[model samples]
Structures are given as structure tokens and as C-alpha cells.
Target: MATGANGQVGHELLRALTDISRDPDPHPYPSPGGRGVQCISPLPPGEGGAKRRVRGRPCEIIPAARNGTLENGTACERIDLADLDGLPRALDRIAPDLIVNAAAYTAVDRAEDETALALRINGDAVDVLGAWAKQHDARVVHYSTDYVFDGSATQPYREHDATHPVSAYGRSKLAGEIALRDSGARHLIFRTAWVYAARGHNFLRTMLRLGAERDELRVVDDQTGAPTPARLIAEVTALAIAQWTDDAAPLRDGVYHLVAAGQTSWCGFARAIFEHAQRAGLIERAPAVQAIRTSDYPTKAVRPAYSVLDTTKLRDAFGVALPDWQVGLDGVIAELANTRFMNREK
Candidate 1:
């Protein structure tokens, strides 16, 4: 079951899972040994000289969210993580073997005022899910953020790096991580940075809207991280889950950094969005994006100055190769353009 199914990553995950379930790639991953290929689909008879045949079966996607309905009018199970008392009953009713907890209290700045509310959903709720998963012997897949670390590192952050969250939202997320670990449940916590998508309230969509209306925009250049697309995150998650299905190549549970390759400041990211938007006819003219320091635009929540995450561990473990940040951005732009063109025709 996928929680927060209407969210940016959650929506993409539904699509990715459907696609993989219907027609799984025979060899979808690189071998951890490097250079060799790994197979996730059904092994053919007498091929590769393997004794056992690994087959991927169709997956049943039970989308659970607070709304209990998708934008496209699809009905889903209602799940309110904030309701701590009802959480276990909801999970019991759903009875999912693999719980993908994509839901979270994502109001970063607002978290300062509502720390308890944020902790209830982001921290305490995850504890319930983790304990339930542990008792039922089910697996869990949870998404985390780079905010767990303070912006002090000059180099890319590894999984084992020290965590020093500076804001209430970060602390809440860190609490969830700790709760899940303490539960002793089999879980994969993916820490991603600067996530956005073609749709939804994200940096990409915000840039497109602002670039069209404004002639100039001031953006922060001090903070740095990868602009990871939601679709890429979903695709990688599906691949990782597939690896777990393969008895010959089961994945170990741990936290891993899942983001697009390469890094850039917010100013650079905004500039790239406008650049791609102009080429895709998303904007008639690109705006002049002014680079400014973090202090120029302050918010309630303090952001990490540098949150670039190293993907070496993720790559070495899952044999998944992430595309460059620019590549992912280009694809999202194309998607936005296609949607625009279709709407115009209608």
C-alpha cells in the first residue's frame, strides 16, 4: 500500500508500480559486483544456467491518503496518521505486506508553530507503523529528508554521517527515523533533497508560475543540493523493491541517500527551470534570476546551507544509477509542455 498516494512522489509511485507490474524488465539493474547485469523479471528456461526461476507477479496497489480520493476520481483508503489511536486499526484493515509511508507533515516553516502536531504525524505516527510492521512481519519503505543534517559539511553526506537538525521540522523527521530504527522493523529510509515534480506545489511548478508573471526574481544562492524529481524517486523505489523480491538478490534494510546526480544552489536551479521552460514554450521569455544570500530572504524555519548527499552507498547496494539533475529537469519540462499543449487543444 502507498500512503499519501496523491502526493508528488506517491502519485508517480502508483504509475511506476503499475508499469512495472504489467511488464517488468527482464534485467532492470546493474550487478553490485559492477559491469555485470542483474535480472528482476522471470528467468527463462535453461537460460543463464540458473536452477531457480525468479518471476515478478502483478502487484495490488492500495492507495491510502487523508483525502481517500485521488484527483482523477479514484477511490482510496482513508488514512490519518495524525490520529495515533486509529493508526493501528487502519493498518490492520488494509493489511498490506509492504507499507510505503509517503505521507508526512511537510509544512516546514509552519512546523515551528506546530511542533507537537508535526511530531505526532512525522514522528509518533511512524512509530505506530513501524511497530505494526514489526509485529506483522511486513516490510516498510519510508521517505526522509536531508534536513536531518546541519549544513556544516563541505563534502557530500554519507548515510553514517552525524545528524544535527536545526529546525523543528527536521527534528520531527529525525525522531521518526529513530522511532523506526528502535522498532526493529525491516525498513528502507530514503533521504532525498530538494524534491519537485511537474505538478504539485514544488519549486519547479513555482518557478514556472513566477517566471511567467514576473520579470525578475531574487533567489538564494548560498544553499546547495540536488533538485531531485519525484518521478525519478518513484522509479528508483520500484526498482529497489523489485530487488527485494528476488531471493537471490535480497536487499538489506538501512537508510540510503536517494537523489539525482549533481548539485546546485537554489538560484542555479531557478535559472535552469526558466531556461528549460523557455525552450519548451512554458514561458514566452525567461526572467532574470538575481542571486542573493540566505539572509536576503529569511523564513521561520532555518534551511541547511549545504545538503548534498552522496549516492555511492545507494549505487553500490542496489546497483541503481541515478540520472543527472539536469536530465531529470528536462524530462519534467517536457511533461509540462505536453500537458499544456493537450489542454490548449481541448
Candidate 2:
């Protein structure tokens, strides 16, 4: 069962799951319930959220938030995090062996004022899911953020690094990781940074729109990190799940860093976006992207000066490695230019 099916990673997760099921991917471990994907959440209100499916299997994507009535006639949508008991009811209806969770309160700055709400969704919710997984003997794949660190490290962060989150959002994410660890369930926690996708409310899309309307923009250069694509996260997760399923014992449950290779600043990212945009003819000319310090553009919440994550553990364990950030960015830009992604909200 896939949670938060509408978010950036969730959306691609569903796609990756579908790809796995359709392909004759050899799984060393036998699928307990056979091969299939069932999404617990739906799309936006109007697109018949429960209608999407996988090609060669009994796939389903159910649309329901914690407040909304679940497929089993139980209201398990919006408060699913706060409502612990509702998970069992929803799980009973879905009977999924693997649960991929992508839901979280991701508003960085706003989390300061709504710390409780953020914890409920990002932290406490996982506590409940971990408890459930322990009882049911199921598996879970969860995503985390780079904010877990305070950005004090000059090198890429490892899974064993001491965590000190400076913002409420980061703290809440850390809480989720701890909860998962304490639960003792078969799980994988992926810490990713500077995540942006071509199809979501991310930095890349924002830059495209602004670059088209304006001739100059100032982006932060002091803060540095790898820009990860949501697509890469999903694909790697699918591969990990396959490995985990096949090698039940040797495949130990732990944390891994799944992100694009290389590093860049927000200013560098913007310039690359504009370059791709001009090449795609989305913009007639590339705009002037000026580099500025993070202090020049203050935000309500604190961001890490550097949030690069080391993927050596993940690569050695799963034999999966992500490509460079620019490679993924170029593909996303080309996709955005060719498709009607700009008009998605309309």
C-alpha cells in the first residue's frame, strides 16, 4: 500500500511500483501476497482518484485523505497519522505486504508555528505505522530529509551522523526516523536533500516560471547541496524493495541516502534551469542569475548551509547508484518543455 500517493515522491513511487510489476523482475524472495500494487490515497478531487492502475496486475489507487472516507467506508484519510486505530482498518481492507509511505507535512517555515501538526503527520504518524508493521509483520519504506543535520558538516553526511535539526520540519522528520528505528520492523529510511521534480510544486518549476517572466533573479549561492530528482528516488526505492524482498535475512533494515550525484547551489541550479529553458525555447533567452548569500534572502525557517548525503552505504548494499544531478535536471527540463506541465494546475 502506497501512502501520500499525490506528493512528489509518492507519485513517482506509484509509477516505479507499476514498472516493477509489469517487468519480469526476478525477486529472490517470493511475494507473500503475489505481485500487485495498491495505492491507499487518490489523486486530486476531480480526476476520479481511484481509477488509475498497473498494466498487468490487479492494481488499484484508492483516493482518500485522513478526513475522507476510506475505501472500506472508514474515515482514514487526513488524521491517519493521529488516528492510530484507523490504520489497521485501512490495512485490513488493502491487505498489502509492503507499505511505501511518502506523506508528510513538508512546509519548512510554517512548521515553526505548527510544530504539533508537523509532528503528528511527519513523526507520530510513523510511530503508529511502525507499531502496526510490527504486529502484522509487514514492510515499510519511508523517506526522510537532509534537514536532520544542522548543515555544520563540510562532507557528505552518513547514516551514523549525529542529528541536530534546526527547524521544526527537520526535528519532526528526525522524530519519524527514530520512531521507525525503535519499532523494530523491516524498513528502509532514505534521507534525501534538495529534492525537486519536473511535475510538482518544486524549485525547478518555480524557476522556469520566474525566468520566463523576469530578466534577472537572485538565488542563494552560500547554501550548497545536491539537487535530487523525485524520479530517481522512486526508481531506486523500487530496486531496493526488490532486493529487500528477495534477500530477507542478509538485506538488513536501515537508513540509506538516495539522491542525485554531485552538488550545486541554488544559484547554480537556477542558471542551469534557465539554460535548459532557453534551449527548449520555453524562454527566448536565458536570464541573468545572480548569486547571493543565504542571509541575503532570509526565510522563516533555517536551512542547512550544506546538506549533501553520502550514498556509499546504499550503493554497496543495494548495488544501485543515482546519476549526476545535472543529468536528471536536463531530462526534467526537456520533459517540462515538451509536455503541458505548466498548465497542470489550470
The C-alpha lDDT values of all candidates are: 0.84, 0.76
Please provide, for model 2 over 279-307, each residue's C-alpha lDDT reduced to its tens digit, 9 standing for 90 to 100.
77666788799999999999999999989
Candidate 1 lDDT tens digits, 1-346: 9999989999988877666676555445434322212112223444322332224577788898897898789889999899999889999998988899999999999999999999999999999999999999888899999999998999999999999999999999999999998898888899998999988899988887888789999999999999999988887787777666564322468899999889999999999999988887877899899999999999999999999999877776665567789878987888888898999999
Q: Pairing residues by index, what is the TM-score of model 2?
A: 0.84
Write down the RMSD of all candidates, one decimal each: 5.2, 9.1
Candidate with the greatest TM-score versus the true structure: 1
Which parts of model 2 are misplaced by more than 4 Å? 26-79, 341-346
Runs of candidate 1 exceeding 4 Å displacement: 26-55, 247-251
Error of 1 at 264 (Å): 0.6
